[model samples]
Target chain A: MNTLIFRTIAPFLAALMLVFSVFVLLRGHNEPGGGFIGGLIAASAFAIQGLAQGVSAVRRALKMDPLGIAAIGLLLSALAGFLPFLGAMPFMTGLWIDLNLVADTVPVSSVMLFDIGVYLVVAGTVTAIALALEEKETD
Target chain B: MASTAAVSPALLEQAMSIAPVPPEHWLIVAPVLVPLAGGAALIALRHRPGAGRALVGRLSILLLALTLAANIGLFLMVVEKGALTMVMGRWLPPFGIAFTADRLGAAFSLSAAAIALLAAIFTRGEAGTGAPAYGPEPFHLLLLAGVSGAFLTGDIFNLYVWFEVLLIASFGLLALGPDRAELDGALKYGFLNLAGTTLFLVAVGLVYGVTGTLNMADLAMRLPAMEGVPAVTLAALFLFAFSMKAAAFPVQFWLPAAYHTPRASTAALFAALLTKVGVYAMLRVLVMLMPAPLEELSLLIAAIAAATMLFGGLGVLAERDLRRLPGFVLISGIGTMLAGIALHSPGGATGAIFYGLQSMALMLALYLALFEAARLAGTPDLMKGGGLYARHPLFSGLVLALFFAAAGLPPFSGFWPKALIVKAALDIGAWWLAGAVLLSGFFLTVGLARAYMLAFWHPQRPPAPVGRGPQTGQAALSARPQKLALTTILPLAVAALAVIGFGLFPERLLQLSGDAASGLADPAAYVGSVFPGAKP
Candidate 1:
């Protein structure tokens, strides 16, 4: 259980994975990566932290209850689906809002919000299960 | 509605290019979305104790009421103008995820929302009666969302997803009580239903593989044109899986075993809604997509119906627990629907659909009545709780009406549907189906009457100790045996009135059910509504 090398590298590895996860989540709408995969990556980061330290450390790092995070993610994803309803469209119809930056204008769609929500949902669910198992073993 | 083009010309163009979304399409998804969103929100606020749970609980009920209103609106719309169809994300049919609200789906959704609203209210009484793991408000919301989604979805895979959603929620509800019996029941319920859904998924895969599409309308268009045997096999797979879920015949064992394990009101909701959903799926898929195969399998279907009816009768006769008796009665109700469905006549289909809705109300009323009856006698055993008719006339009266209705007696909601089903059977010259229907009704009457006599009309007997000893909050029920809370009274009244309303206006229900059946009989209208320009 006392692997200094794993503990030392865990933080750096988790941090890198989290960054990569966000990158994947953002690109999910247009390309190969999406919320599900990105969330898995982020979850693996937390899982690695749990293995290196303990579930309490992972909980401290996340700074939120995993289930609460999952619930929020679900609400956000469902909210994304609801946006189109305001536009008088069918459920989950993609609606775009244009964001104008100083340099260029960007089109942000509800689909992106949906993807991020999925990412959080996946990450939260995985982290929750992993932490629960870790805690169970300690008990 | 600002002209965003003034700010950015290109953005305006992009926004304008999106088609003017039909305002009615929002109604189509409201039933599903309201519950989904509400459930997610409830889950987020789940950690909040007393006030939080209570607030969310009321909000969830309010949302269910809203969904029911939407369902009524959707039903009227569909009744006025055939089926309503919407494609998610604007993709065309066979390629897009589609949702279609036909009369059947609308009716089932409305009934589900109604049952859920009452169940949410009933849970107020049972709130702290079980393990906190029940997650009552959020889980109930999720369950309603699943039921609505299942009824509303037009794609086959989406139906499977909805099934999983409800199944998961049911598992949580089923295991809520602290009794080890609840866990045992949950395990059986869980594994059997998991296997059923798995089989359903496999059938969906096979059907998709054969037709290269999952849309119900697309499948209808392509299925008859493709090889016949594989299609028939797929239909049979659906029959098996849905039958298991419906707790029909050989598969009916799980219902009584698992159903009685939950808290009474929860068991009422399950009895009221769950198997009927399976029945709805069977009616939708088999009758709509594979009519020819259904004709071929009519004999098998009839046999299953007969067996389900007979088994249900025997189960009711054998069941000693008052709370559990309703579970077997529910099985009998499923049998009645199956018999109606097996006849494959318009009258039969109408009867089945009508009975499905009626039984939903009646079964819930029966369970709630049982809850009241047990509250009066301080026990759940039929043999122990006596002298109820002498004491609480109103409770006994409601229980009598529901029981008679459950037994398919005349001047009740159950009679009209049974009449339609029996007439259909006779018309189709299916003597066995007709005989089975009548005989099941007879057995149901005898069995229920026996339970009634033992529970209410018999000489007074000292009540047995309840499964859990006199609990704190609900313990007040036995103390105040002479009066019932309006919270408890309201749902039962709503359910009883719905039954009587349907019974008195059988023609209206018959017309709606008839329209629903016709849609199933000739899916051309359903398909056309989904694919407006496509040549049938």
Candidate 2:
């Protein structure tokens, strides 16, 4: 599985997939692509990288522990849920803001933050599990 | 004029009843969100060098204390104003999720949070000083959050989500111990509980399919009007699934197989809260949502309760491992609670609720006491345990009080609930059930007395001198007397005192349970709280 051609292309493929994952996550508020699917895509990308470049390379690239990332994601999601409280709204009520650029208005919402948190949690947990399995195989 | 003629009076009433959200509405969700946020923050900080066991332990205790306070406030609010509801995201009920707290839910949540707080304190001593970063603390808080959510959720599907949350957290906790036994037990617990939740989901689906709604209050309004086989079948499915979760009678094998393998503190938390959630769900669904079906199935439920009590008591008598004994005792207590549900009277419901609350405190106390006693004895096996009474009179006395409470003796918390159940049974002319309740209590007394005699009364022989032949590790460990830590004793003593205090002053709990039961029997207020302005 660790052929020269695959090893050479895996990093660029993984990078492209990560970028695509972020796009998918960002568009999820009104599209079919969301945090869950985006996270899955990124996780699959990590799996591919692990398969080609090995576990250590993937681990070095990731930097933080996957579980810690999942924890931060959880905290972020919880914080997003709490944001509505500042406006005296109910828990999990979505608050929106419009970023008025010179040429266009980009709509942002607490819902998006919540989705990103979900994205990180899913990606981190799945990557952690997959990485653990891959390392176990070599041992 | 035509539009006015087309509208129903109930619809018009509901339209006009859209009152502004009250200021105290946030209290409805606080019990759930507080622990959830706390758990997430703790996990995020878990890898930091400063996040030691002591910090995690105190943080967990504080989080649970906050949850308990929230629950108390919610309970008071519910008591003062009837049921309280918080519809998520400003959406009306029947479309949005609702966190509704009636007497029963609030009381159960309060008891669960209190016991969880006590368990956290007990864990402080059990985890020992300077242990590695407390990985399980976050899961513990998360578990309580799930439990609180389950108690408070007003939507059936939401209840399933809470069950999953608690189940996942429990899986993490059950697997925390280093022993291979922990893994094995976790597998059994996980598989069986997952199956139970799947069954619950199927039941939820069927209810939604038949009734066109998932809001429990809406279902309560709609279910009774629907007739016949579908409703009864749904009730049976719910009963079977929740029975498995509650570890009652036939599906009860998994609990005893799994509960004894976890760390004692984890076991205590499971004992106090997990099955009680199942019982609470049963009370809400069977007694509140579908009374006709429950009545139709009362004979079957009563039989299950009787068998559960008998078998649980007999299992206790047959068991030798001290750690495992509480599992059986817990099952027996569940049977008593089930008996209350089976009776289906206001008195019966009162008994069930009261028994459930006391059982939570009692089980927590019992497990903590046993954990300490086993530490002093150097083994959990009853056969090798003895002389605790000679050396530690206070500890022995505490255990005795807990035992007395467990056996439903007078002047202890267990007695009142059992008495209520028996009277409810005899009032309904269910002589056999009344007899079963009494017989089970007797069996429990005998079983616990045997445990006390074997573990505390039987004198231990002096340890074999070192350097003579080969000394077994158990003997070497038993040679040195183990002192009870103050952290350990303080929580156990507090729990014991709470049990004794409840037993001595049963009036307040009795009144509360009575009100909770009456509220279940006639859920007009609960339904009104959910729908706001809808006519009952």
Task: Tell me, by TM-score, which candidate is best.
Answer: 2
State the lDDT of candidate 2 residue by residue for B1-536, as single tens digits.
Answer: 22344888677544332344555777888889899888877876777776766677788888889888988888888889889888776567787788899999999999888888888887876643223764578888999999999999999999999999999899989877666767888999999999999999999999988888999899888889876539889999999999999999999999999988776678999999999999999999999998999999999999999999998889888888788898999999999999999999999999999999989999999998886787688767788778889989989999999999999999999999999999999998999999999998999999999999999999974644456534133443354459887878887888899899889999999999999999888888889988856755
Candidate 2 chain B — worst ten consecutive residues by lDDT sum? B469-478
lDDT of 1 at B429: 89
Best by DockQ: 1
Docking class of 1: medium
> What residue pairs clash in candidate 2, if any at all?
none
Give the interface RMSD values of the models in order. 3.3, 5.5
Q: After superposition on all CA atoms, what RMSD does each candidate show versus the true structure?
A: 4.0, 4.3
lDDT of 2 at B296: 95
What DockQ does each listed candidate score? 0.53, 0.49
lDDT of 2 at B344: 95
lDDT of each: 0.84, 0.87
